[model samples]
Target: MNIRNEWVSFKIGDIYFPDPQQVAFERHKDDLLDGKVADLSDHGLLKEVFAVVEVEGIEQPVIVPVDRLSGPAPEMSAGEE
Candidate 1:
C-alpha cells in the first residue's frame, strides 16, 4: 500500500460510530479515528493517522477504511509557490 502520492482526506458523519465499543469491534485501524484518506482500496478509502511508533518491532502506517465517510471529498490546500 504505497500511498505516498495517492492520499485523500474527507470527513465522516459524527454519528457514524457513537460508541467506543463500535470502534473496538472494527478490525481496521483508521475507521476508529479522524477522517483522513491515506490509501484508496477496492473496498474503500483508507483513513490516515499521523503517528511515529513501532508495532511489533515493525514501523507501519496507520490506515483504515472510509466506510463512515460522508458528503464530498475535501478540497486540497494550495502548496507553497
Candidate 2:
C-alpha cells in the first residue's frame, strides 16, 4: 500500500469530520469514544495515525487508529498511475 500526504475528509463512527486535525481534537475531548483518525500518509490499508494536533488542553499529538475512517477512496498511487 502506498500512502500519500493530502487533505481528505473522513468519518469516524457515525460522525463525519472535516480533517485529521479536527479528528484529533474530538478524540481529545472525548475519552469514551471509540474511533480512529485517517492516516493520510499511508494508503491501501488503514493504519494507526501519528499526527500532532494543537488542542487547548493537550500538549501532544494524538495517536489514533485508521480503521475508523470512511470516505472517498484515496487518490491513485504512483504505481497505479
Number of the predicted model whose lDDT against the real structure is largest: 2
Q: What is candidate 1's CA lDDT for residue 51?
A: 31
Question: Top model by TM-score, which number?
Answer: 2
User: What are the models' TM-scores?
Assistant: 0.21, 0.25
* Count of residue pairs whose backbone atoms collide, per candidate: 0, 2
lDDT of residue 37 for candidate 1: 40
Measured on C-alpha atoms, candidate 1 has an lDDT of 0.42
Off by over 4 Å in 1: 1-32, 43-59, 70-81
CA-only RMSD, every prediction: 19.1, 18.4
Error of 1 at 63 (Å): 3.0
Taken over the whole model, the C-alpha lDDT of each candidate is 0.42, 0.45
Per-residue error at 12 for model 2, in Å? Answer: 30
Q: Which residue pairs of candidate 1 clash?
A: none
